[model samples]
Target: MRGTWLRSAWVMALSVLIVASLATVAAAEVTTIRWLYPGGEQPVSQQTWKSQIERFAKVHPEIKVEVIDVPWDLAHDRIVNMVMAGDGPDLIQMGSRWIPEFAEMGALMPLDQYFGKEKMSLYYPGLVKTVTYKGKLYALPRAYSTQALIYRTDLIKNPPKTWDEVVTISKKIQSEHPGMYGLGIGGANHVSTLSQYFTILYTYGGRVFDEQGRLQLDSPEAVAALKRYVDFYRKDKIVPNPLEYNREQLPELFSAGRIAMFVSGPWGGRALGLPPDNDRIPYASAPVPAGPAGTATELVSDSTGIWAGTRNLKAALTFLDFITSPEEQVQRDLIGGLVPQGPTMATRPEFTKNPFFKTFIDMAPHGVPQPQPALWEPFQEVIVNMVQSATLGMVTPEQAVKQAVQELRAKGLVPAEKK
Candidate 1:
């Protein structure tokens, strides 16, 4: 009887030990990664992104990803608040332009150790430049967008290659097609208006800041660029109600065939109710027209960065590598409607099959990154107000340039004149 009682007690104790060991193993196997993305709130966008995350989960069963979707308008401020509260996610989908601000704050991981300078060569030079601050790489680009001249192929037999051609073709189209404008223009106080104007400014050898980080709003190049853009509205008269429109209006008008030609990204093709393959579509794209200086356009990119505060840095980087792998990158682009980031993915059969993607691809090498100063938003506002003033006849382009310089100087963005 004594032996029987002892054996039963031993068996019960062994059972308890086994259960505790199994529970510990299960807990150790799971590593949850917090991910934040701007598109997580949109139904279609969220669904698509979640599907990709599910794919990652399948490949790495040990990792669990929790997603937080925030709206684009609120994402920056929200992230700042979260980081300040010491509760930021392990990974984030951030705008390339935002990288500079966030990285400067020391909130992002220096990714050179994970991604390396050698791998940086795989991406467009302009895109690589956008995520680098003070010689440190802070993020990995997932997708990119660049502006190009999107025109109705049935209307334009030959695409314009120069800004002068854009004017000539637009004027001819306006004369021939009643109620149809030649060029799509926007002057509303929106950031996109500034992006559209950047094409023209860059083509004319103008820059927002010189190499010395001094504001160049009143530079001769800047004055000329602004004057030429205003002429498209006040002088050419090909753009309809240029002062009253915003960015969204032009894409919609183009889709309805109300405009003959305009500049936009590949997303415009989708907005037109056309298939992804341009060969089957009635509209096609060309590089943004060249000016006296050279060809140029704005390169828009969204990147994924690991948070500097994450405890799961190794696993986070593994996840980053998985998402950016060539095969997965193509899958992500297909769902997101983004251009591929690197040559390996760009040259893939899947991407090359879509002809509209070709123009964006060609332009990527020659593209210019948007300015990424810590105070870039305020700087962008200066351009917005300047363009609005010039297009609305509130000020001449020369006067607009001078006023912009003054505003920037007062904001301490530009060097003040010595007393």
Candidate 2:
């Protein structure tokens, strides 16, 4: 009896100490948020974030969120300089490619600790992984994209499901309708071209590197991917002057009825359907076709993350949660023309019925993160050149892959394997 009573007292003492400690820690914390976003005069993202600022202020009145939407075009450089100077924002919006560079510099805070797996169940897993570094979640995607084939519904009564079908359809359509290429390759040198090429590369089981982290771009799968893309240029005779094609300009082509089907975003659907007060172009979208193994759809997204150097971490997190909450998310589709990110929000049956978004909504699960690597933006040009060389038939598919891998190694962008 005496021993039992002593043990009970000991347990009570420990519990009391833990509670007191937690209280003291809580008391020491401060509240305020500083967020930086790339600014533009008329971007939908800015408008949405601003409209909800007051509502956010109401919920966390104890915390002040200082929002800075910096000037357009130079905004990426500004954020980089800010971090270099130890003056980073408490929260920042990052492009998919930027995740790896920031993560490697230790400029981002891993959010997995605060919001555990159960909480993470709230978002698209593919998108969550995009900003994850070494299994730790670093950022949350606010808006996301999946590769989908946007088609002129009138042209493809039964949409093509294979590369061969696409070729046949393009030939038939173009032969019948001159000046209208069945498929438009917005072939200017940019992330869009590189990204489109990667979809094929991955579908063929090729990655930038092997499991050992050595350059594997010269592999059979890489050759296969490149060959398929090159055939579209050389044999298909569909894409006209790919070297001069600009993706941003391709939409205008689609709008003007110069192309039947092209790869674009859900926003394109809206733009196509409602050029000026619902002129309503007939259209539909679907997942990018399957490679032999499986289909891979790349998810391009912008994510919001807590900056590592912030003093007001708790306050910043509060804002993140608030901004991503259901209330703010309600306007997600209406405002941005972006698809839903969380299962709670994304799986709504009503959204699936919206014919324009159905195929894309079905494709959300198969999305891949834009490959995040430390200093990826700089090396992207080489990747584009490699594809351009192959498309123009300057080199064989295997040779192009080989040269790209060699350049990647020489640039030291790809990390050497740990022995």
Candidate 3:
């Protein structure tokens, strides 16, 4: 009987030990956050992000962030798929224009609770405007880009100050330099194409919406803007195969010395195989030529946003706040070849000392945000299609504008007539 009792006691002790082991294992498990970063599988960019994540882990050892490098080409569609599956990453690297679409779908968390209005002061006004939707903040802008005209200084002694001068100099350069194109232009169905057009549209005093948020695609200002943009291809004959290139192609062409003038963000230095301040190359940057109205350029910003469905909202917010702080932001900007968001980072002597960086920094204050139409994703398709139609001679610029307006109205995106 004593032997039986001993056996039973040993079994109970083992069971208790097993249970305790399981509890300890559970306690040791860290909360992991999957971050869909926009490094696009590039080794260098991924390493940078991983290093940053390691730093974040050091401070917040309780939270483990798993960085997933989503390529730029597939990021949007991949994110949409993940969100639809109801198993999206805890955090996503989002473009400024993407906030509306994601917010409309209820995929993004409204960060007002953690980051109030006072925190908004940390970023530029244009950056702030991009993240706010329906009076709610969805994301924090980390990096921003404004377009600048990069030209071959050897080809043109005087950089163009106006649109007309851009044309004349491009013509002169093309005529003088054989086997070289005058300008690098893109009209393909891509986000970059729409952005290239936005710089011109804004410069010509065209706005996508009025104060009331009505679509003004058919407005006289918008129509006029479309004409001049298409004219760069149809009449100017300056851009070769403008219909075939996209954003990435322009920078590549400029770096290869195939084009004389190319408009791109400061990040184009990566393709140039040089730093923004380096004058080793014949290329130099200038503000995009001002149109009749004044200087205008596209403000492209990519931000970090938390998924609303994530159970780890608090942890995600902590990571977001840390990454966007001035220290992390400046480090990311310098490493990523992106323009800084706040004045402190923008005016850093490092940037101010570099003429190429200085030009973009000076223009940041006057820069405008990309259109934030509710249907921005689809509207991008509409705008790119219209530009392609006009550039390829499928329709006149006026007809393209009319059709775009009609499409917008049919989609219930805009009113049928002016109110």
Candidate 4:
């Protein structure tokens, strides 16, 4: 009986060894890729992404994806450090403006090979241009937005169609409403301030960089744009203290009935609890007022790229293709309150039929992308300061523009004029 018990124990040990070996072989067959995602850390955002990964896993059982969520404020520095150390993730989310900076660093993979003309044509041409740096495509657009006028329908039956009309209507609105302001403009030292100013600048035919990439911030068109924008606060007095507000804050102020109108992206509707059908929302969206040059809105986008040092290139490309598919893109737009990135998703009933989204979609053709500079942060600082100084009565618009031009020249961001 004792010999029989020993034989049974030996058989059990052999079976355990075989099972462990099989598990190890299975694990080795799968490729794992790391994705550094920024600005979706909330519980709902987290769950949504988790579900997406699970769905992808079922289709590509040979690949395993690990997502790392990082806050927006810290993502840039973290990515720089990791890339410099040669320890970066396989995939990364990038702000469109950062594409030039990253491409210059030689840390991103050129994606033209993976996405030919056929696949590249899936995105808006303007959006695709933003992700291209020095003639090479480095990323695929994942999020896109363009600004528009969001006004209270109860206050103004007809939205302004021209710059003069905007000011005139605003003055009347302010007079009718005792305590509330007519418009909210962002003057804080934030990126939104730059975007707001760009809309006006482009509308007036002002180009920050000429076709040859020379700075023109002090041009006649640019000066006129700034003067008119500052006049809203100083001359017309239809806008509140802009020094206290940024783009994000203006929407809240509008919701609280402190202001009758503001310019924002599609997310503005979501902030005001606007449904897809525009059911009970009191606000309506319209194109930005046209200027001498015509209407132009700042086009902003976020894109995804693969790190140059990634070992799992094939897996990274597979994940990129999966996430950027038409169906996935539509779902992301709905959940994040972003504009559709391509025509396929834009034509969907969810966007084309929705009044608020349709307005932004119609405005996409007139969108102007932000200037791409390798030193974007410092360049943005100069533009923001220019707006703030002029609005706060620190200097005249002409003087402000001249001073900003001098600073840009000193920083070597712009070349001296060809005399």
Candidate 5:
């Protein structure tokens, strides 16, 4: 009986060894890729990404994806540091403006070879251009947004069509409603400050850089735009303390009935807890008020890119394709409160059926992409300071613009004037 028991134990040990070896082999066959995700730290955002990975895994079981969530503010420096250390994630979520800087650093893989023209055509041409650096595509657009004028329907029966009308309506609204501002403008030291200013700057036919790449912040158009934006706070006083607010805060203030109107993206409605049909706050969206030049809005996009240091290039590309697929993109857009990136997505009922989204979609053609500099932080800082200075009565709009232009020139951000 003892001999029989020993034989059974030996057989069990052999079976365990074989199973362990097979498991090892299977693990070796699977390619594990890491994705550094920015702005995914929120619970809902995390769950959505997890679900995406889970779906991707069911389709491509041989690959495993690991996501590292990072805050938006830290993502830029973190990515740069990791890439420089040769320890970057296999894939990264980046602001479209960062593509040029990363591509120039040779830290991102050129995606043109993997994505042919047909595939590239799936995205908006302007959005695609944002991820292209020197003829090479570096990433796929994931999130896109264009600003619009969000106003309280109860306060204004019709949206403002011109800048003069905007001010006029704002004055009327504030006069009727005490303790409530007619407009909410942002002048905080933040990126949204630049976005808000740029929207006006573009509407006034101002260009940060001319075709020759010369700085034009001090141009008459730019100066006029800035002056008008400041006048909303200083001269009209239709807006509250803009120096204390940013774009993100405006939606809340609007929802609380503190501001009657604000310029924001499609996400503004969602931020205010307004469903497609039933809105908690009675509001409507319209094209940004037109300037002398015409209506214009700031076009912003976030993208996903393959890291140059990744070992699992094939897996990374596969994941990128999977995540950027039309169905997946739509799901992500809906969950994130972002506008669709291309025509195909715009056609979806989720976007087309919604009036607010439809307004932003119509405005896409007039969208102007943010300026791409070698380093966006310094450039953004200069512009933000310029806006804050003007709004705070520190300087006239003209002087603020001139100082900003000189600062950019001193930093060598502006290209040399053509000989």
Candidate 6:
């Protein structure tokens, strides 16, 4: 009878242990996270990024992330429509300018609460500011492109450090390098490229908006900057035939040794003929040089935000935290144009090493540009036509600025300056 009682007790204990273990396993089961990003054909999108997330999942066995790519061209409309219709992904990729507009509409979850003591030291400053709009962080940047000077360093040997020097160098290079232009610019995809030109206007002590939030394009500093830009294409003749240009076209010209320099994002270094980073004929970069404000560079961003009305907020935030971790930055997103979202994670050794990116990193944290208005597209279109019209001699730079101001005011897009 004693033996029988002992065996029964052992069996009961074993059953309880198994039940407890099973409950523990169930409680710690993995969660599924869905991610949506603007699509890319680059290796970053196709193979590398997927494997990266999978590896992250390996270490974090409690979460499984699935990436769904959306066409870049349709990303804007798709995201807005999906969110408006109340059926979007758990996460959405967003641009810096989109933060304010979306957050104001309650489309994003403020991340400030989550960025407390435990996880604050994992991103770059530029990336952090992008998601923080009106003092609330609505998203977290995963990677970003820093502004840089893309010049044929070998030819210029000593590139210009200021506007006046830029002009002098261009004039000499134009005369010496036959069939080559001194400078070139992006005309394609003005939405993506226009800021490269606009940021310079601000650094010249030109304000697009007055302290009262009114148009201030008529300021003398503004006019001077506009004239300086027009001078490059019109007066200096350093740019290519105004008819044969657009974005990415400069890369071909630059790689062929046909242009001395250009202002572009970090991606410019990878133009085809340019040798790899360690090779000769490789590209180099620096801050977009000083103007009146002493060398300001524009802030640009790429990040993931929770889509409005997502059914899986908790899951999405988990995935965001994982991707923005320092390990993933080096293992996944540390390519030159690709940057981390957290202020601390971006400065890790992986991001600080490349010379071209390092120059950009140095300038980026302090030199953020002014926040563009929600309707940047309309303003962008007006600026392009204005610049092109002036460049093609259809109008004076003064007349173009006047027309731009008039058009904006007529639409009530800009308030009167001097408010």
Candidate topping lDDT? 5
Candidates ranked by lDDT, best first? 5, 4, 3, 1, 2, 6
Best by TM-score: 5
Model 5: per-residue Cα lDDT over 118-144, one tens digit each: 888788887887787767889998889
Off by over 4 Å in 3: 1-29, 275-281, 414-419
Candidate 6 has what TM-score? 0.82
Q: Please state the error at residue 35 of candidate 5 in Å.
A: 0.7
Better of 4 and 6 by TM-score: 4
Model 5 CA RMSD to the hidden true structure, in angstroms = 2.0
Model 1 error, position 411 (Å): 2.3
Show model 1 residue runs off by greater than 4 Å: 1-21, 210-212, 276-281, 414-419
Query: What is residue 211's positional error in candidate 6, in angstroms?
Result: 8.1
How much is 321 displaced in model 5, in angstroms? 0.9
Candidate 4: C-alpha lDDT: 0.85
TM-score: the better of candidates 1 and 2: 1
- Rank the models by TM-score, top first: 5, 4, 3, 1, 2, 6
> Any idea how many clashes model 5 has?
0
Q: Report how far off residue 366 is in candidate 2 (Å).
A: 2.3
296-359, model 2: which lDDT tens digit per residue?
6777878789989988877888888887775477576657777777777766765665777767
RMSD to the hidden true structure, all candidates: 3.3, 11.0, 3.9, 2.5, 2.0, 5.5
CA lDDT of every candidate: 0.80, 0.74, 0.81, 0.85, 0.87, 0.68
Which of the predicted structures, 2 or 3, would earn the higher TM-score when compared with the native? 3
Mind giving the per-residue lDDT tens digits that candidate 6 earns over 75-184?
76777787788777788776666766677667787778776646655655545666676567787766566566777666677767887777788888878878888887
- Model 2 residue runs over 4 Å out of place are 1-32, 209-216, 273-280, 415-419
Better candidate number, 3 or 6, judged by lDDT: 3
lDDT preference between candidates 4 and 5, better one: 5
